[model samples]
Target: MGQQAMDTFRSCIPLFQALSDTARQDIILLLAEHDRLTVNEITEFATLSRPAISHHLKILLENRLVEVEQKGLQRYYSLSLDPAVAQLKALIHTVETTCCKESF
Candidate 1:
């Protein structure tokens, strides 16, 4: 692979790794059902500590899987579909396009 392709693949690694964690996965599922939520609201559904929830949110934020909307003192977390989907689509497109073009 070229430098650009390698760079894109490297960038996507964290996203996949982030989803591999059960705690992070649960947070994503929770966000999917609701429009948005704050840490306090999320804590109501989870057994994790406030700091643990915050930590998972931080990873999800870093992976571009979720976004936060701050309203005054509250920060609402929501799933960010386009970015994660785009990255996945890019990876799929690369494999389908490049791999299929090759001869067996």
Candidate 2:
């Protein structure tokens, strides 16, 4: 792998870590279905506690998997997956082009 591909793969580490948890996956699905939701709203549909939801949200936010919108006193979280998806696609392309080439 070239340096650029290696760097792209490294940059995706946090995104992978954030998505490895079932709690976080549930939150992502909820947001996808609802468009946006507050921590309390997410906790209502999930078995996790409010603090646990917040903790997962923090990780998601840090990884850019989700975005937060401030409305009045309420904060609504929603999916923000374009950038992460692009990075993953790039990594896949790099691997396909560099490592999957067939010899004649």
> Which regions of candidate 1 fall more than 4 Å away from where they truly are?
1-4, 101-104
Ten residues in sequence with the least summed lDDT for candidate 2: 95-104
Residue 88, model 2: Cα distance from true site in angstroms? 0.5
In the predicted model 2, the residue pairs found to clash are none
Q: Give the per-residue lDDT of model 2 (tens digit) for 1-104.
A: 78887887888899899999999999998899988999999999999999989999999999899999999999999999998899899888877777677732
* TM-scores, each model vs. reference: 0.88, 0.93
TM-score of 2: 0.93
lDDT of 1 by residue, 27-89 (tens): 999999999999999999999999999999999998889999999999999999789899988
Error of 2 at 23 (Å): 0.4
For model 2, the stretches where C-alpha displacement exceeds 4 angstroms are none
CA-lDDT, candidates in order:
0.90, 0.91
**Residue-pair clashes per candidate:** 0, 0
